[model samples]
Target: MSLYLEAATILESPQTTSLKAIIYNPSKPFKSPQPKLYALIVETLKFQDILKEVVENSGILKLERKLTPLLSILLTHDLLLTKSGIATSSGPLKDALLRHKARLNAEFTRARLRRGHADIKSLIGAVNAEHSRESEDGVTKTATGLTSFNPRWVRVNALQTTLEDSLSSPTFHAFQEVGSVSDMFFFDVVRKTYYRKAEILPNILAIHPSHDITSSELYKSGKIILQSASSCLPAIMLDPPKGSMVVDGCAAPGNKTTHLAALVGSSGKIFAVERDRRRADILEMMITKAGAEGIVTTLKATDFTTIMEGHPAWQASYILLDPSCSGSGILQRVDWDISKLNLPSSDTTSSHPSKKKRKRDETLPNGSASQPEERETKQLEEEIQDDDTSRERLQSLSDFQVAIILHAFLFPNARRITYSTCSVHAEENEHVVARVLNSEIAKERGWRVQSRDENPLSTWHRRGLVGELSDLKSSLEEQRRVADGCIRVHRTDSLGGGFFVTCFTRQVDDKGQFGGGIGNLDIVPAQEDKSRSQVLGDTTEVENQEWNGLSDEGPNEAVSAVDIADGDPRSGKRQKRKPGKAQQGRTEKTNRQFQKGRKGWS
Candidate 1:
């Protein structure tokens, strides 16, 4: 296949997969050189809007029946924007495009003039500036086409080195230090700069996204981590005391796990639980890389809900629950917007007739016209399918999120718990918070939303939406207070992405009991002959037993009815568990009681 056709096929890939991953996939290699193909796709996407307009105005797709919308757009991009013209052999396809060279050039010049650019260089600069603004906003656009500030947030890993030592290291020796994040946001494109963000978050810095820091020695040594400022909020908000026991309920890809380790120091211990074996491996690698192997215990394939009274993590005083939800707040790639380009319609009839009328059955060199049209239709359908965020999906996600937090509440010694999500929806944020706060376990354990004045992130201006908490059984004053306690980061706030975090706190008696009697809440059966010491020592061991659970990564993972049925507020039915060796000793009565208690939480 030609480069244009191959690049078009790559563009048709699902948005969930990263472009780099598709380009560099070793199993299914492309005909073109990977680097050259990747560059062509990226550069073409950068000028997609301009090329779309130029091609449509020139009527190239209409005149040349063989050229598809995507093909015309790609070929036209190189023709007008790149130093080298079309990178293809001299064929009928080339001849068709070359026939309209004069008209295409005129349309390209017209597009520049329409955008108020005096020259091509000035126009290209404007496009780069616009892209920079979009990156800073993290792809969230306002009504006025303005976006929030989104700088590349970097955290100095305290486990390996201090922030001061990192800044003075050889990796950042050439970088000019700026006074504010805004300075870095509007930095001179040619100069290297960074801004220290100490006012709200410590050991964090903001740098322009254009700067490539992944290759630096600091990053390679794990002395620095590429985490968003919003993602760092939970660890900072929990504020676990030095040498405290903590649990990261959904820890994987362990950015927050390592941050918690840095806070607890070598004297503290953290149990990072991840149910998925694949993600657990990634979490283990991150823990090792951050030099936190001694501090964090990897609980691979163990569900947070399974950590009952007998489990080692049940005694954790501090817990951070960043559970699964619709990742609507996550920052998207700026280049993904290129997929929404309005290419010229392929059905438009040609104004000029052929010199000698040829039969319509004669296929073009690439393919028949109908083939490209079908492909275009299929691509549009895939785009729409991938973007689906139906209300039913959100409801399912909210139910699972509420279940995770309620399970965290069951921890006898969990004094402080912070529940967070990178979701803008109230169904996953304020609604889930309200549901958990109103749960029977929370009421029995005295778990309540930590007041704003006591929260570590109280200085953050954006708070939870009080209007979304109308369903909560609280007075208007109380609801407002609860909303004020939650910290919300808007996608346009430039703090990185849209995020929501709220801390829950309660008092415990000397015997690790809240003021109420222990109810008959027999959820999971206690493990026999296991002590805290034994469990803690077995941190390095991966559990071979499989537990049905959902991934906290995002909405992509499927939610098992058996795993979340107890906490799912709307699920009225349960799936029967298949009898296996793991269920040998369990009686039917105990299973019934477990199911009954699970329904009570909802």
Candidate 2:
């Protein structure tokens, strides 16, 4: 995935570069044996040496890396199969692997010896045992086949068909069939140890993590989506009643939008709004693929904030707001070919430090690059990081976020509105919730955090952190309840990534105006400076670390040093950043500092 992204603008972003590469990869399923290509890339990337020197090595082109790995791993794993085929350290497999160890090493040595003009077709033939002549050339090798390692978790897309029906079909039988796997020689049959997700989320299945279910017929037909158990929380917590109306603010690449469609069924109405035109197109495609055209209305290129009174969405009984944020809690998976794993110099310019710059670079220990372009990208990342933590940025994002929620609060029929983010940062999660709770709209409409006991996900072991609620105006006891009401998923908890979600409910009086009628609130947007100062007060704690969605270091991992919150929002397990230039701008002062940085540091 990273190799294909070499020429793209997303390559410079430290966040989600690998994930985006996979999503936008040309080899994805499109009625081709692209699944095989995907498998080949995934397995080959596990070998760290090959990935770094050959694929991620900037000296190579994007197309070259893709072609080389296909011939190398795919062909080798295919022809050099054991009797059972699966590459595991078992009785027969262990013996087979030991037997081929010497020969496999020799082939890799040969490939490296002729790296610049290596004939992949010929190397593939050598690896496949096609040439008896090459076999006697004093080469040692490791086991040729690889054991596939795929994480378990399957989401039943209730829109296309019921989970029961899909599981009962012949398509599911492949899990027990040895030959059905992509590699014909692989021996271990996929396990049938599928367990229903605990609690009210009946459609979610937690299968044994080792099984490869991506190629199942149900998955191919969109009867099931490979979503994590945690990602399905927000929609379930919202619990939108059947035949009701709902709005999915920030609903692009619509997983929750379609989930809402399933709950509402054909009789219900859903307005799926996305701000970006391109992502909206993808959302529309997802909606169509999920068979939710009748239930979901695609509001393409429409910002949730622009949605106001008199719009059909204003009458929605429920709203799911999952706005963008620093994706700190997002799980960082290592699977890309050209990753942030290394900040290499582009051919056009050298990223290495000069004699003077080497001295300047030593001042900042965490700083990684010396190249002007690389430094510029890092500086922009730092600025964005700074801005996100700055009271100004948080307040600005909070105001817009609160406005979106407040807008939902104004809905005449709104009852349950759930706010979520894939960010672990408090500003976007707890702080935003606290800010909205203190607003006049919340007070007047009787909007309060839904108690955990009432939420379907209340039984989840990892609830919201208590410390983040310190800023909320509620009593400590109430704050604890509010924290319990919120659902938090850790990145390493086997959910797709870190996430946070909480639902708000309004109790209306006998007066119809407050009960179910759409009433207007004259809200004056708060000044940025005032909002910042008010939200942060006079504390150094306000300057929290920005949560890069792709960072493996989670918020909870740093809880001892910083009291940052841990959670996620959205029912899709993870949220992706909207398309934009990742590298923004650089300043001269920053450049001068990098000019004195040391070489070999980055």
Candidate 3:
């Protein structure tokens, strides 16, 4: 996940040129005994990097500093590995790290000599405290080989498959007794886990040991979709009308776009927009596969800010925006290269001092031509690219989010817009929402938070002011309140990816009918009838089975249904349980916390 770390750091902006570097020279996962990478990342802050520079320029100095350090910690320690491979620090890994450490100390010493002693000392103190946390409460390896697999659950959509059908297959035990409202299930093997959902496609399930389901017959035929419940939250909140004009502002590779299309059935018009041409092409393929080609239109939109300015393809009544962000919300293992554990011996290369270079050159705190300027352009480029900067991308991205909000609310008929991201950053999520809601444009347009709850009838009166979101007034007056009292989902919560979604409707205007509103299309009878058939067919079969009871006649009549064997762990357990599928999801959600992205808004 250094990709997650490097991506966050490049966004930081610095006032002075302090060289910062992350030593990831290990070509393989680090051997055990490697000093905490978290501390190294914190210490790296002593040098300025492109990430820090961008963040400073964006005026999120504090966030840049805080997030970059955390990203470093996550990258160094985490490993996305197979069950058989347990990484540890070997001699080479240790030596490379030690050499890198030496270079950083020397750099810090030189930097201290040039700057304010107080500032330098404060940074060092922060680094020390961060390292101390790692030393004391640092993570340790748990189960492996057989134990490493977490029993992540997957759901079969109610519209297609039944929960019982997904679980009746062998290797799964019924914890139907331990479930929730989202129609989720758990494997008997791995306990205590944050479940993964299939977000974009269909109601597909993940097998504990099976990772090749994507190429299977069912997935290829569109019988199942791989989507996460967290990813499903925004569309849940927006609940776009079945037949209306909708705009997916950042719709590329159409996850939410297809979801919106599915929810709308076939009557609605969904314009799936992507800025990148290649991504848009891929999105079209995805749309075609999902059988949603007719209802959704694909476009190569370079700037969503001007989505409505010059082009008049569709006056969007609803919009879904899942903009790019630092992938801090991802909760997966991180693995490093084994070779990075050790540095090459001096004799391995030339006897000259410069000939034996340090791995510290792999990354930098700040961009500088101060040393070997012209000769190392390629090296610098590689280093810069390694650090993915969200601030630079977000400078345009956040503005794009705001611009989409403006356009969504531009016409009186465009009532619903769901602004969301995979980022946990408030600057990208809540702040962008606040900026638009507080501005005169949103107010004059008469767009306000449509019920904060997905239930539509649930209402709350909330409005925004500039100083901070907390100062704003909500009809219910809660600190977590959005500008118009919209619900913003965090990765720290159960369902919904690290995202922020706010549904809006126009409040002031009565007649702005020219723009295409959701009222345009009458419900398509055929689409509804097909869904009704799916439900009725399944239900009727189950009812008929129930009507035919098991028999007890003679020795040949002995039946072997899936009754629990006495040796099974849950054989005798009984409790007041919730509905099987729904209960499984709700229960797991409560027990497991949200997966944190390596770095975030804080």
Candidate 4:
């Protein structure tokens, strides 16, 4: 098929299939290169409004019966916007498009003039300005444009390279340095030129959102990571000591896991736990890419709540929990904006009255009958308003969030834990924090909110909303202190997205009485105690064995409990396990049974 036809097919795809997935699908590959196809689609969508006006005014769709609305838009984009005309070779479609080239060009110029532009250049600038404004305001469906106030945050991976070395690298040679993050917000149509070193977070740099840093050598080499400032707060707040063991409770797509690795250095060990198989694969890949494979161990298909007394992760001194939430605070995806474009229609009533009616009643590609134009537009408007933060959903998420944190509190060796979410709702943030603090485990283990004065993010202006914590059974003064300890980033804060994070700390004595004891140890049955002892024995044996890196089965493969060991905690030394066929067979069986139980939790 022609490039125009292929582009049209992709544009007409149902909302269920993302534009990227359809364009990049290997099974149904396009004749044209994927990158070229993607660029054409994005550029066309950006200029679609003006192109739609031009096409309708020129009456090309009315005259050309063969051209679909999507086809005409794609062909018209190439014919007018691009320097070179249509990319396809001589054909009936090409011949037909070229036949109306003069009229199309005239209509485009007239459309530009109608929009109050003196020339094409001014019209382009105006459209770009509107695009940037809309992206920052996030008031329209196409809100996350190429340029916006939300600066692209890049963190120099200390595991691979230092911030000073990364800045001196050739990747940033063309860029000019600015004094503040606010400077990165100003959009320049020609090019993105300025970058600001973040004062609030170490090794973080904010750059113009328009700059495609992923294409840089530093990013590809894993020296630089694209992570939001809000997401980085949890690790910074936890500030795990070097050589300390840490656990990331929900460590998939591991931005915080790798950050923790960077802080702990190679001497420290990090257990990155992820219950989902697919997401564990992603976490492993990220850990490998960030050059933290040595410092970080991925716990694949392992639920955070399932880490009992026998698990190696139970010995972690620090834990970071970023649990599932409504995701109400996340920035609208740029691809989502493009996918929701309102493509111009080819079925003009003037040309074919019956055909227009038939098109209205036609079943869409996803098998849903098309609605009236008015209803469709209204539905699109409604979709722009996020409904995921409904009361029922928030309460469910709050309960889950409290449960995850309560589990973290059960860690016998845990000294600190940070709970965070990409949610703007109070129920998921302060409410969950309050609920966890009020739990019996939290009070018994002496897990209290780390004071604002002691937190590394003390200088950050935004703190938790005290009003949200009114339900807590604590003094107003104590409630205010807890609220002040928490950090909250607003969606419009220019930190990239809405986020909430708070640290909890408790002092541990030598005997581990106040901070180290498990909350419900007496409630467990005798049979369960035997199983726990076996699990601990198998884990200890694995730790004493050779310290080889990820298994030969590839990073995505689940790392069995018997395959990993933290070594003797007191001596901090590796001792080879005594060889015995019967003992090895029993250990293997136990590991398999333990894995089965963990999978069942998922």
Measured by TM-score, the strongest candidate is 1
RMSD of every candidate to native, in Å, equals 14.0, 18.3, 20.8, 12.8
Model 1 local distance difference test score: 0.67
- Candidate lDDT values, in order: 0.67, 0.52, 0.40, 0.66
Better of 1 and 3 by TM-score: 1
Best by lDDT: 1
Sorted on lDDT, highest at the top, how do the candidates line up? 1, 4, 2, 3
Flag regions of model 3 displaced more than 4 Å: 1-212, 301-313, 336-396, 454-497, 508-602
Model 1 / residue 494 / CA error / Å: 2.1
lDDT of 3 at 569: 16
Find the number of clashing residue pairs for candidate 1: 3
Where does model 4 exceed 4 Å of error?
1-148, 185-197, 334-385, 507-602
Candidate 1 per-residue lDDT, tens place, 449-555, comes to 89999977878887988988998887999899999999887656767766789999985568866544533344444344432213323321222221122222122
Pairwise lDDT winner, candidates 2 and 4: 4
> Which 10-residue window in model 4 sums to the lowest lDDT?
358-367
Q: All candidates' TM-scores?
A: 0.61, 0.54, 0.46, 0.60
lDDT of 2 by residue, 1-602 (tens): 23222323233334443332343343432332323333333334333233233322323223233333333233334323223342333443234333554555454444344433143333332232211110111111211211222234566787788777867777554343222212322223324545554465668765543344544556545577656555577899999989999999878657777788889888998888765665665566556656677777766645555454445675788999876555645543333544523322223122212233222112212212235545433322332342235567665556556666776776667889999877656677777788788887788877889998888776788777678889889899988888888887644344555678899998666764553233665534334323322332422132223321121122222111111111222112332222112111111222233223311101
Residue pairs whose backbone atoms clash in candidate 4: 543-565
What tens digits encode model 4's per-residue C-alpha lDDT throughout 106-129? 888776665555656555544543
- Tens digit per residue, CA lDDT, model 3, 1-602: 34333333332323131111222233344332123333233333323332222222222223223323334222222221112211344444223333334333444444333333334334333222222211111121111101022222243433334445545533233323333322222232223212333232134333321222333433443334445445565676677877878777767555566677777877887766665665565455556545666677665523344333223433566777665554333323222222222211212222112322322322223222224444233322332233345565545455545655665555434666666555545565667766676666565555555544533323322222222464233443443444445544332233322334566656532574432343442322213223222322222232222211111111111111011112221224322211234323432342232112211100
